[model samples]
Target chain A: MTTIIVIYGLLAVCLVASLIKSRQKTKKAFLVAGKALLKMGPSLLAIIGIVGLTLGILTPETIEKLVGAEAGFIATVVAAVIGAITLIPSLIAFPLAGSLMRSGATVMTMSVFITTLVMVGVVTAPMEIKALGKKFTLLRNGLGLVAAFAIAGIMGVLL
Target chain B: MIKTLKKFAIIIILSLVFIAMAIWLPDIAKRSSIVAWDYFKEMIIIMPPVFILMGLMEAWVPKDKIQKWLGNRSGIKGMAISFALGTLPTGPLYVAFPMASSLLKSGARVSNMIIFLGSWAALKIPQLIVEIKFLGIEFTSLRFILTIIALVLVGKLMEFLLRRKPDKEYVLPGEGN
Candidate 1:
């Protein structure tokens, strides 16, 4: 844990130094999203709403007890299905998986959950559509869901 | 006042839904809370640094450079590089998106950007260590291989879609008007 902290700290320092050195050369538009994120806040909120709903519906205990040793495989399926309708940050997903593991959840479960959490985002559909346009967002996320499940399944098989 | 009211209305609707779920499917609410908190804690520790890293990337990397490296003109080679770059150690998906949006605006192909963002979230190195520790090396290796394939495939699919009829309204990060 200490080592992790130290490594992260060094990373932070490096990033900051890089930022400082390049501050003058960097475009303000790039750094601040040219203040458009605020306008996009509502879309972001909607995405959050979807994520919360999915998280609320799926429980780690339910996944663990039900899936057991095959938890990883089961998790991939559940995550892919859920991910098809949800959107959440990876930071939140990882720890959620960690917590689940602490309580006897399988790697397959965590792996699937994390991958889906990132890749498959149904909740963000509207916002994604609005931003990147409909076809692009849907195709990307759809592919992502398939990938999440495949990855989980393959991991289960090989690992 | 109207905006505030709208916000409040949204919150109320959400709360009512939660209340309904709690009342009817009480187990769901209870279980979700139990799961959410466990994940939430580690997130608290890791997220700040991740956010900072993202901010730094935003603050440092030039959009043009990103474009030059992985723009639409860069083709398949650009896609491969984007995939590898996206696999770099990083944080959650949300934090990465803003940076990605910036890249897109600077001429980075949407396909490559999407691939990078997707892979960034799915294929983290440090998180992989944690996964290995908990799940064993075999599982970790499998997950990695699967995720990589998925990310690449997804990227290709996204490219195909973009080619069909790309949207002009996508407001890139720096070019948000």
Candidate 2:
């Protein structure tokens, strides 16, 4: 809700400022935006479908069951892998993490899940590759997974 | 047109999968469709303004200015600016991709842009509040500190690796250089 308002508000302000400066440039901005949006159409749709499928299949209960049933390093690996592939909205994900923690999931597993969930985007890789190129996407995500594990290991020790 | 259709092959396959799920797993299908529809609506509402903002940036912000502000020699200042720009916005990571692309074209360093994208994904303000809520202050603070350190390391590594050998540049659709 706030995100929408802030974005639209910023857009409205920027659009007006650009229009006041030069109608031609403002029109060009619109053209660029439209072209980029059109170019991204397929990848965006694919991501939405994939997110739906992943989240639909891995409900919070299902996730709890999966992560809870496992223990030790294997559980952390499972949590991280699931987090990497699924793009669950943080709103649902944090609470799910809380519940998982209560259900005996380790800090390492929960932290790994949350960290990878934010940093990695296997499902959205097509869109990312389209926007940022294949190499950039792969390197960023690959490094992100490594960092997630490191962070999780530290959190496990400290917390 | 054919190229466009080829790009959409994944979507077509996904639709078939959805149809199959609807036949054999109606409950999952129903849930999936509802979740997808919600996300679709969010995307429709959020993406236009984001793209428009990126377009405005592309049109208005000069390349040299971007370079000076976020370029390699910009140093610590550039990283700070990138972090500020990233953390201020509240959106999914996808929304940052186009903006990052535009900035990169304008000569922003890969390291700085990595910081931008990293903070955009992991260090959001609202996201922190939620994390603190469910996960506790100690846990949230620890992750935040660790994430910053990790992001800087990762960003510098990417910069080094990419500079050693540049990757294929991607041209936007309908764009001609």
Candidate 3:
């Protein structure tokens, strides 16, 4: 994919530049990268497992089924809750949301679903807590939940 | 060793859950493993360079530079920079967490950091194209506009709440991250 190519290209260029400018500093950067990667290994594994479970069970077809079956405010709330918790890759999620829209899920529900899906990360909270600290993790995600609802409500009303 | 053991606790728990799922719900378990394997490939592929970039940043970029660019007084400029940096074709949300931690240690403001993390999670340019493709221009554009506005609000709100208390100094993960 383009993402892979661009990142590797950039990395290659940067690595060459860093090595040319200061081999020792470049070595230290690799050291730091290794340390950080090691520190994160366990949590990363945990997150991948959670993502797998989420996707395995809550496939796009299943999401469409669940969101489409409900209607009104309750449906929006349900959608928001699901979105807040699940970390579906946007590649899979948008098409799923689009299809749900075509099938009769309300605009409010779809918008909230997509918004919360991006903003909130209940499943990844442990990794977040590890990286950002408990309070920062709590406040960012908690406030994000509020903002997601507000965006969804306003979008619901407008479009 | 205790700290390392503590770190693995959640992984162990999740692995146990996976095992339980495998026993009771073999189909879902198989599906989950497949999904996990797929993501694992993606993560290893895209994550190294990302961490290298962060490592390079941590080693090369000075704290004053980060602070001046993304610190509180930098205001709208700082916010804009944070959002722009985040919208880069980075791997995923988790990849941003370590960099955000580094930026915080390097003295980036909470508000800008919030915006950075939020946009990284939600609003990558490539992801937006995908969104527009599937969801339509109207839907994509509107969501984009709204997400920006909401992120700005979220940034300000988090800054107000977290910074007001003073003791909430985000401890960098083991010093300057």
Candidate 4:
């Protein structure tokens, strides 16, 4: 993907620049990277495993069906909760959301699903904690869940 | 040793659970492993350069510079910079985690990080195009505006709470490193 290419290019440039400027600093950078990667290994494995399980259990069809089958406030909540749980790629999610909306899903339902889908990550919480600490993970996701609903409500009223 | 296992307890348990699932339900296991493998490949391919970048950032970008650029006093400029950097070619929210962590350790503001991660997740350029194509211009635009506002509010609130509570354990014993 373009993202990968850009990152590699950036890395190459930065690495070369760092190397030219100071081999000692560059070595320190790699050491820091190695330490961080080693630190993250377990949590990373945990996240991948969790992602696998979640994707397996909740296929795209299942999400589409579940979101499409419901409506109104309750449907919105279900959609939001499901959205918080799953890590669907954006391409797949947006189209599904659009169709669900066209099929009579409320503006609230789709908006909440979209908001929480991007903001909250229940499945990724463990890894998040490993990286950003416990309070941060809790506060960010907790506030994110609250804000997702708020945004969804306002959007529902306005649009 | 025990502490390390404790650190990895959830993952260990989950892996065991996954193995059991594999034994009892081969089909689901196969499907899940394929999905996991894809993610693993993505992670492996994407991670080295990212961590290296983070390392370079940590090593080179001085603490005061981070503070001046993204710290509390940096104001709207900080927010703009964080959001801009975040919406770049980064792959996922998870990838942003370590970067954000390093930023925090280097003295970046919590509020800016919230903005950074928020925009990265919800408001990237490529993502916006997909959103516009699939969800319509109106829907996408409205969500974009709303998300930006919400991000600022969330960021401010988090910065306040996190700053207010210095006594609280912010990071795990060895995890902050």
Q: Judging by DockQ against the true structure, name the best candidate.
A: 2
User: Best candidate, TM-score-wise?
Assistant: 2
Estimate, for each residue in A95-119, the C-alpha lDDT of model 2 and write its tens digit. Answer: 8898788889999999999999999
Interface RMSD of each: 5.8, 0.9, 1.6, 1.3
Clashing residue pairs for model 2: none
- Report how far residue B154 has shifted in candidate 1, in Å: 2.1
Q: How do the residues B1-177 of candidate 2 rate in per-residue lDDT, one tens digit apiece?
A: 998679889999999999999999999999999999999999999999999999999999988898889986888999999999889856899999998998988888888888999899989999899989999999899999999899999999987777666675843221111
Candidate 1: list runs displaced more than 4 Å: A1-34, A46-53, A65-79, A83-114, A123-131, A152-159, B1-12, B19-64, B73-81, B88-90, B171-177
- Candidate 4 residues B66-134, lDDT tens each? 888988688989999999998896798889999998998887888899999999999999999999998
- lDDT against the true structure, per candidate, is 0.60, 0.90, 0.84, 0.87
For model 1, the chain A TM-score is: 0.58
Q: What is the lDDT of residue B54 in candidate 2?
A: 92
**TM-score of model 4 relative to the true fold?**
0.95
lDDT of 3 by residue, B18-110 (tens): 999999999999999999999899988988888898888888888788888987578899999999988998667898898898888888888
Docking quality class, candidate 3: medium
Q: Considering summed lDDT, which 10 consecutive residues are worst modelled in model 4 chain B?
A: B168-177
For each candidate in turn, the TM-score is: 0.66, 0.96, 0.93, 0.95
Off by over 4 Å in 3: B1-3, B166-169, B172-177
Per lDDT, the best of the predicted structures is 2
A55-95 per-residue lDDT for model 3 (tens digits): 88987777777889566888888898889889888888888
DockQ order of candidates, top first: 2, 4, 3, 1
Q: Which wins on DockQ, candidate 1 or candidate 2?
A: 2
Classified by CAPRI criteria, candidate 4 counts as medium
Candidate 3 has a DockQ of: 0.71
